[model samples]
Target: MKFLYIFTRSAYGNSIAREALDMALASAAFDQEVSLVFAQEAIYQLVMQQNSANTEKKPHLGVINALPLYDIDDIYYLAEDSSTYNLPPAALVPQAKALSAEQFSSLMSSADRIQSF
Candidate 1:
């Protein structure tokens, strides 16, 4: 089945982002197609060069990088959110794609299952 994981929260200050990544990895491991959508504050998760050492929280870049290894490369972020946050394409991880709000909605609708974090 095709699974779409929507992340609407930041990776820091909570475990939801990690949980969503885990779910995506697991789904991919099971030979299922997995796509990730980052919207709202979740867009922060894709920002490169994050430093979490001071907070003692594990940096999420490692997990984000591992997505490709697990064959879960369909990563997308809302263009509206990126623009609002002044995030240029170069500021995001290499694999992140910016999609218009309409395209994002179309993707969600095309998924067989949707899970939000």
Candidate 2:
């Protein structure tokens, strides 16, 4: 089944983001088709210059960058939110594609299972 994971939080200061990533990765390991969407504040997780220097949590980007290696490459972020947050396309991780509102809606419609965090 196709599994969609939606992330709507920052990368640090909490474990939610990492936990979600772990779950998404685990789903892929089990041979599930996984697609990850970073929305709202979660877009920050895709920014190239993530500085978790002051936070106790290890920088989560390392895990995100390794997603393609796990064969989980359907990564996306909302284009509207990205622009509103002033996140230039160049600043996002290479694996992340910008999805238009209609595309996002269609994606949600197509997923067999979706987990939001």
lDDT of each: 0.91, 0.93
Worst 10 residues of 1 by lDDT: 11-20
lDDT of 1: 0.91
In order of appearance, the predictions have TM-scores of 0.96, 0.96
Candidate no. 1 TM-score? 0.96
**Model 2 stretches with alpha carbons more than 4 Å out:** none
In candidate 1, position 112 carries an lDDT of 99
Cα deviation at 35, candidate 1, in Å, is 0.5
lDDT of 2 at 42: 93
| lDDT of each residue in 1-117, candidate 2, tens digit only | 999999999898568989989999999999999999999999999999988878866888899999998899999999998889999889999899999999999999999999999
Residue 44 miss distance in model 2 (angstroms): 0.4
Off by over 4 Å in 1: none
Q: Which candidate should be chosen as best, given lDDT against the real structure?
A: 2
